[model samples]
Target: MKVRVIDNACRDFKNIDYTEVSANKICYRWQIFLEK
Candidate 1:
């Protein structure tokens, strides 16, 4: 049971990391566009 809980937590962390990376990429592109 403890192992299952740890696995779920790891998955959630990975998903959050992915979302943050995508957001950063979008923000970077917008910055470049505005600079032009």
Candidate 2:
């Protein structure tokens, strides 16, 4: 199945911190770098 990543990421994101963020963001960042 396909994922509306940004929307799902936003919904799933729970933790937010200065040093780091939720797992969703980390996954997206990896996708952006790897996909690009």
Candidate 3:
């Protein structure tokens, strides 16, 4: 799974890379997921 830098992350989080994110599964915000 690969993800691009769609938008910069929160200022508190810098130097964070895409691989670090949980890309293996369907990851999304709780609110957004519910809407779908």
Best by lDDT: 1
| CA RMSD of each candidate after superposition | 14.1, 5.1, 7.8
Model 1 regions more than 4 Å off: 1-18
Against the hidden reference, what TM-scores do the models get? Answer: 0.49, 0.40, 0.22
Roughly what TM-score does model 2 have, to 2 decimal places? 0.40
Which has the better TM-score: candidate 2, or candidate 3?
2
> Across residues 7-35, which tens digit of lDDT does each residue of candidate 3 receive?
23321133443343543222344224445
Best model per TM-score: 1
- Candidates sorted by lDDT, descending order? 1, 2, 3
Decide which is better by lDDT, 1 or 3.
1
Model 2: lDDT to the true structure: 0.52
**Candidate 2 segments whose C-alpha is farther than 4 A from its true place:** 1-21
Better of 1 and 2 by TM-score: 1
* Candidate 3, position 24, lDDT: 23
For residues 1-36, what per-residue lDDT tens digits would candidate 1 score against the true structure? 554554554456556766766655655555555556
